[model samples]
Target: MPETALLPDSAAPAAGPEALDDTHYRQSFGALCEDQVVSATNAIYAENGTKLIEKGSRIDRELYARLVQHKLRDPIDQQIGIEGMVNHESLEAMAAALLDQATVPRLLAASLGRPAALLQPLRELPLPGPIALKLTLMRDRCPALLQHALATLLVAMFLADRANMPTPLRSHLAAAALLRDIGMLHMDPAWLAADRRLNAQERRHLHAHPITSVLLIRQQGGYAPEVAAAVFEHHERLDGSGYPRGLRAERISPMGRILLLAELVAALGHKFGEASPHRLGLVLRLNHRALPGALIAQLLPALQGDVLASKVQVEEASQRFAGVANAFEQWTELQQDMKPGEVRGEAFAWLNSRLAGLRQSLTEAGGPPEQPSFLLAHAAGDDLHVADALALGREALWQLGSICGHALQRWPALADAERDHAAGDAAVARWCAWTGAMLAGLPGSSVD
Candidate 1:
């Protein structure tokens, strides 16, 4: 069992009448939605001080419908703060509470399976007051969003720290992480809640969300270009398979890569109830070619080993295969000096031999590798980058090898930080330095 933290006192629900501040109220107002409770930052009334809706009232579906039908007679913005807007003072308190120990999830604590040290650097990281207020208000409308935002913030901050991202860039990353999925609020609730696989059209609509989310953030203004660009590319993949913009790894900003990885990890946890670091790492592996491997590699060290012995083994094995594939890619690049036909043939031969050995190893280990082998066999080489072809092939093989006999485990959420924690922020200033150090540290292989 791991130690856990409790939610802070300030997280307590606000009851009773309150008025939204007059100027801020209008600037941040939006339409009321079903099941969202909103309040006035300042008292609001109709033409003659007749209160139309009390402050701090929970707007149920029916009330929302009625409010919509009549447009609330008086201007909706003047009458009620539909966004549950919070002021700067409240925002600071709310941000503080997110770091409280009571807020740590138990399962996450168990997964960490070690002493819970405060991430002091993360605690000290600067967050804009307005960003916090905006995100908190957004969370009021979509309750689950806050969890995702917090999770993304945690992971992104950790990555930013590890990569030595700039301080300004780190702030933008945090903002982007919090607001990247804001467009989901505008989608149909039914669609958002559906558990089944989306049809093609539905996926296309969902794919458009990155664009919409960026637009919404821009409308709010005061955000840096880094923030807007990251939000726009958060869903994109390294291999151009991702949506709205099919951007390649080099094309995606560094913050965008971190945001993408963080978002995926957070989503996995939300869907299955627990996303252990190891599992999340495997997700990175399985999607290795499509994602930024360097960024994923940076996060691999943080995952707890052997949470389930076989799962960890599989992840390790997958990582090994990815390495071999990487070697093959580098080898192919060197072969650019050779005849194109010979290079292609040599690449195919190398891949086939590795896949054969991987299959045999999985069989001996009692893991299944047949399906991924077939997929690899079917993949068209002409369309892939030389490196991507090998990377994706290895991933498919590793996926089959890992899933052969074991069920993918979903750990229960026993504990988690209620709010973000403090961790070192120096990475924000030294990402390039770290990158240079890392590349220099890698052992070079002979091209021959």
Candidate 2:
């Protein structure tokens, strides 16, 4: 069997706030100049006092090689300007278009008596000059990222209105959602590629984006401290599965929780297309422990209407579910054979707890894992039922993969003399093997 690439914990020390990498950003910005006007407002310099670009220089593809080699004294974003950058007027028009054309926004608007009120929070948001410049770069260079931000902002505002949050807090939530991913602009572009498998060092770089985002927001100077706090926690999961910091439950701020959920909703819609509402409902059902139940309850109402078919093959999905069930049984039997002391060790105990939670989630989403074939067979004739089964199976498989990843990452940290190292390694290897095989066969699976 081919070995699955398990993401082990990175031993590299955390990067300090001042060490933001802009190699990829500079390259992408220079590429942007090939089509549009981008120029330096102030002279660009390296850390050693060499001037890289003159104050009024027009940045183009020719300058990219020069800019990328140096460790810049100031971030390129603060020193450069793009023509027709995103401002309040352009952002409002974009939000208005999304409200008219997007299904999620339309559904959210239907819940409100005055759908136009949704755009108010976005309009009132304070987009300082630096923030507008970053947004413009994102729009021109990474259009999908900007769309995601706008989608998140719209959904977050809808939720905030439903909760009757004060206007100031609502605006802060909007800012948090809009700017949550600005840190990605500074990361290596290869690390963010959807099809690429990340090495541990690359994964570390990807995970530290939240910290980088917080620093950028602080540097921009107009956002509230809460906006930065929310941005920091946007990737966090309530059950402590999230990264950069594995904060759980109430340690995540109120606005942080809202942004996290909103981001998930936006990402799901982007990934699943017309069937996003259906897929999102199943994901929320299976991940109640990882997300806030109250937020889920509030969001569920918007997805209540009819959903388009997901186009997943029923027979193939059933077979995949059977494969997953067999893997789960194998892990359970392996656990039963372990010595009591080994089973009680911290590492094994943690893995067992997460697996147990997944088991419960599977049971709640469908029937027991053992009976997946039976349930799927019963629902074979109805497209919606079959789609639900397929979606549920996919989510369970993804969650299982996540458990294996966490096991690999946490094993070294949780290891101790009392733990059985050989047995633990073997168990994690087996789980990764099972997850990799299952994920390999499943279509559109993004667990890795």
Candidate 3:
């Protein structure tokens, strides 16, 4: 929709077979084979020309040990076949089914002229052999991921069509959305568990998933470079807050922006269920700096009249905002004593700028930092107003926590600065502790 050209593929060249970490994938595939009918279509061989599995051999847990130990002559996805894998036909059916039931998909379909024509792009997409095999495995193993991918595809196409993009570009956007998460197939299943709190190293591994997916798509061939570029930027935010690479502004491609917004919409639907549309409105309002405004303007028509019917307690919201105010107050006090040239001062300055933005967003959303309780009390009886206010407050708190996490990640020196200035370090620790405790009380709030 933005019409920005695709960024050059400055990412390193696609990884060869030897560089891939396929152990986790092989283990997942093996487990899937034990449950589903999966087998080798050709003889699997190691790099040394030793035959591992004969052609047409049923692959299962027994073959997993053998497969994981070798550096294969070719990628395993190229040689394996899964029964009833997701092909173009099945994918079309899946999209049609989702349109019939899901609110967002239906809205997207109706937004695009002919409701039935929404599936045409997906129907025409080229699913190469290896990509199809990987998708089938994802369907059998990580069904949630597959579901998210399908939802993202519908949203991307809807956005592309609304922007008057060409048919070929629309096809490329659809492909990028659908294949963006395939890299997760190669990641350890444990790393994705909902309750698992990842350390910095684990988080870094998770963040590189976009790069992993780009490599996989490039190596598999048949896709245009635009597809890989869009996938690489799917997790990136326009404000440079996104991971793997902190790209900002027009540095992100037009297709990448469409894909990123689509990904967020799909994820919100999963995270908030019936209230996704409502929560999405608030997220967009607070994050106008991070997401494209024009695309959001187009999306607003669908969100209208989809307000949540649930009630939010005034006291609960009041407390949340009070916590937000207190956190900012502590930071202000700490900032007073900070020197501008030092590392900790620079870190605090960065945090201050982000927090200032958050404060302004909250005020604009009817919950000013200095007078949150007053605003909540005034809107106490109006359901829509209260919901909007509470949603804004919740999102602001979540983002505040996220800012702290990013600071810690971006400035490893923040921890070291503690050694030089114990008092300042203590104050920063106190602020982080307060924010964490406050966020724990919210239903879906987490630091990053």
Per-candidate TM equals 0.52, 0.86, 0.90
What lDDT is reached at residue 132 by model 2? Answer: 86
- CA shift at 133, candidate 3, in angstroms? 1.4
Query: Which parts of model 3 are misplaced by more than 4 Å?
Result: 1-14, 46-52, 337-343, 412-429, 441-444
Worst 10 residues of 1 by lDDT: 405-414
Per-residue lDDT tens digits for candidate 2, residues 333-400, read 77777776553456556777777788888887777887768669767788888888888877777777
In angstroms, give how far residue 151 of model 2 lies from its true place.
0.9
Q: Report the number of the highest-lDDT candidate.
A: 3
Cα lDDT tens digits, model 1, 208-294, are 677666655544567677776788788777866565666788777777888888787666645433325434554566666667777
Candidate-wise lDDT, in order: 0.48, 0.76, 0.77
Give the distance in Å from residue 87's predicted Cα in candidate 1 to where it truly belongs: 7.3
Give the per-residue lDDT of model 3 (tens digit) for 1-448.
Answer: 3212333345544456655687788788778878988788899999999998899998788876678677888877788888888899898888888887776777667666576656788877779888998888888888888888999998888788778889988888889999999889878888887778766667777887888887788778888888988998998988888866889977888988999988998787667667777877888878888888889888878766456667877766676677777777877876676666545556555666788888887777775687768677777788877777677777777788787677667655444534554444545655665676767775545532
RMSD of 2: 6.5
